[model samples]
Target: MPRDQILTFFSKYIESELGMIYSESNDFQLQNRLEEIVKLHNFANIGELYQSAQKGITGSLRQLVLDVATNNETSFFRDPKYFRAFENLIEKQIKGDLFSDKELRIWSAASSTGQEALSVAILIKELKQKYASDLSFSILGTDISERALEKAREAKYFQLEVQRGLTTPQMLKYFTKNDKDMWVASSELTKHIQYQKMNLKDAFYPHEGFHFIFCRNVLIYQSVESKIKILSKLESSLVDGGFLILGVGESLIGLKQDYETIMLDNAVVYRKKQKILKVA
Candidate 1:
């Protein structure tokens, strides 16, 4: 078969499984990204890589391909503007009957390696001095990558990963170096997190009715259909008036109308619109 035909057949297969759209406009980008994986796996070229993907690619290698296609740019307190908004939202939420049992629940959907989720915990801890008198919180971080989830469960990161969004004071207070010289979440910070593997395409999540759901930077790889389905599920899974924070570059346009946009100083966030039932 010719090269274009082969590429077409395989791109469709890849996009079907991972929902990463590639076309004439962005084929070069995909090819460039796949080049490194080809070299890493010792494949001669794209042709051999496709053959391996068709039959011989291991589960882990398939995941790597997906990761390469979907850029997972994340870090602790990534974009402080959003963190500031989140803190303010939490403070506002506690002033009313929003939470029961004095417990705050947050879900870091597609949490990757868990930095984002831990950042939320750190913010909560810092703010506890003022309002969290008897309240407690739990953060649930979900991702499709088992390796990422393993690292998240370990609560460890390399120096560069830790430095990306962490300040010197934050580095000192919330993390310590391990025997391998890797920075890790402090003992206190990990207590509130539960890392698990979850695919957003699924109809049900492990937990539901989250007070705050952060599905940041994960939707860029999804198809419009997948986006609509997942966004709808997320909206329904939130407590009435609960928060939904998307990535700064993302918008809920042409997807679903389950959320009302809340413009903030730093970033844009959304609130699940509570349905008011009219008596029949």
Candidate 2:
């Protein structure tokens, strides 16, 4: 097949499967990535790899493509302002007696390698220690890449990863170094988290809505249509009055969703507005 044909095929396949756009403007980047995969697996060449994938990209091959295509660049407590905003939300909710008999549920919708979710776990632990000793909480960390999910489940990070957003005291308190010098998350932190594989392109929502959803740095890769669709689903996945924190540059300015705008702790977040019932 022609090079253009191959690029088009893989581009369409990736967007369909992962909701990530590989537009013509970035064809060179995508081609380079495909070539990297070709070299990594010794696939004769790009054409040969395409031929094999054309037969059917399933199982391990598909996973390898996805793992490479995804940008799993994440670190502990990424964007401190976001965590500060979340802490403010928790305090406000607690003041309103929101957790009287409820479990605080948080969903890290694109929890690459689990740092974001684990950060929330650590923050919540500290909050509980300060005021709400009986506070109950659970965190669901989901990512489309199984490889990333595996790393998240392992709950281990290198020294550099641990240092990215952690204070020395925080690290010493919550992580222990293994023989390999990897900082392993303490049971106290991991116990409240569950890692799962999920593709946001799919229509999925938990039966019990989450109080906070972190879909940060994810929608930027998606097409505008895909972004709107995912945002709509995210809105539905949040409990009324729940919070949604997108990446710092992401916004709902053009979207139809009516999530209330919230600004706190130098971060702008969105809150799912309470639904009103009309009289019959």
Top lDDT hit: 2
Model 2 lDDT tens row, 48-149:
999999899998889889988888999888888999999987876666655343688899999999999999999888988888567789999999888899
The whole-model lDDT of each prediction reads 0.81, 0.89
Looking at model 2, the pairs that clash are none
User: After best superposition, candidate 2 residue 10: deviation in angstroms?
Assistant: 1.3
Per-candidate TM equals: 0.87, 0.94
> Candidate 2: lDDT over CA atoms?
0.89
Residue 199, candidate 2: alpha-carbon lDDT: 89
Q: Which sections of candidate 1 miss by over 4 Å? A: 1-3, 39-44, 56-58, 277-280
